[model samples]
Target: MSKTTRATQALQQAGVPFTVHAYAYDPNAERIGLQAAEAMGVDPGGVLKTLMVLVDGKPACVVLPSDREVNLKKLAAALGGKTAQMMKPADAERITGYHVGGISPFGQKKRVPTLVEQSAFAHEEVFMNGGQRGLQVKLRPADAVSALGAQVAELI
Candidate 1:
């Protein structure tokens, strides 16, 4: 079944071509990103996991591949900040208008500064959370950067 989300709506409005993917979410899965990749039959490298982080006390997003973890020091340096840390799940949910396991860089409640890992562009398409659990949005890496107004960095 296909449905719309704030993210999908934004993509459409931006004239960004994309495909919606819906899957049965298994709450028991140990890793949401990996599970999403497995469920969608895509490479983990093509799946981006959006992380909410605080760079020098301000909110920001780091979009990186599911197979990698954000290097906080490097990200902070790239953003010209003294320190960076992951936002708490509750704070992240409250800020992004998305649940912990389904945060997307698009359609966020607040326009937080965002950094997209340069490695994401290595793939033709990226599969990322679609503003909700059990759904993902597929789009070209360039489209994602344009849509999010993100800066490219070596975040991972």
Candidate 2:
């Protein structure tokens, strides 16, 4: 058996039910979320992407629908922070120990506060990156929050 990645290992430890989907790499793919949705045969709306943002000068994670972009003002309000800004890719990599396309809300190298868009709750399961490129995990939104100790909010 192959060694599980940090994301998978965390899910297993937390007893969060999930299914792994793997697909061939398309070098031409532009958006990570779209790639995952296409590869997993799921609706773009049902796929969520993890974004790193700095809220009030603190690193935070925002999980949003793949089809939409994060609204910084709404995110700031949801987080009760004065401001929210996108984190630099290098800073994100340093904080999560994963590249931009492979960043998972769970099992990050550092425990940063996280918020998931409330829309995600409507879906039975959401597809998100599995700590590696070309791999994604299908899991309940609630389970994801529990695993990551994240807060659910209207962050769209």
Candidate 3:
């Protein structure tokens, strides 16, 4: 796709090699993560979802596989924080500068600590939001880790 978004721009500027993937967005679909995986015909395990979580009231980004859930206790322990809670949709958007459904851990209005699930690196490449609904970016797991300053953790 020729369309550009903050996430794409960030990746480009950082010289991170990536491929863009786009699919029809279903506004009414209840499970967007599953829908995207189905639309792309890719393994759900290779699709990463960006989640904004608060670690002691400070926003942090957690990147994990679409097929898994973030273990709050594990995440908190990994971050060395006493508490962790998901950011409200509005708060996530406001903080990440992307809509809730399109948040990418790669680019944001501000930088926050990022933790990527350790298992995600098992995939050669992972697909994630491209800063907009219906758009996804495919990139090497290591490149994502390096470019985003993310630490691999047992978030799942």
- The residue-by-residue lDDT of candidate 1 on 1-156, one tens digit each, is 346888888888888999999988788888788899999888999999999999999999999999999999999999899999999999999999988887888899999889999999999999988988999999999999999989999987
The candidate with the higher TM-score, 1 or 2, is: 1
| Model 3: per-residue Cα lDDT at residue 38 | 86
lDDT of 1: 0.91
Most accurate candidate by lDDT: 1
Q: In model 3, what lDDT does residue 54 have?
A: 97
Model 2 segments more than 4 A misplaced: 1-3
Q: State each model's C-alpha RMSD to the native.
A: 1.1, 1.6, 1.2
Q: After superposition, how far is residue 43 of candidate 2 from its true place, in Å?
A: 0.2
Please provide, for model 2 over 1-156, each residue's C-alpha lDDT reduced to its tens digit, 9 standing for 90 to 100: 122679999999999999988865465787778877887777999989889999999999999888889889999888888899999999999999987788988789999989999999889988877888777888999999899888888876
| TM-score, every prediction | 0.96, 0.94, 0.96
Candidate 1: stretches off by over 4 Å: none
Clashing pairs in 3: none
Count clashes in each candidate, considering only residues at least 3 apart in sequence or on different chains.
0, 0, 0
Per-residue lDDT value at 95 in model 1 = 95
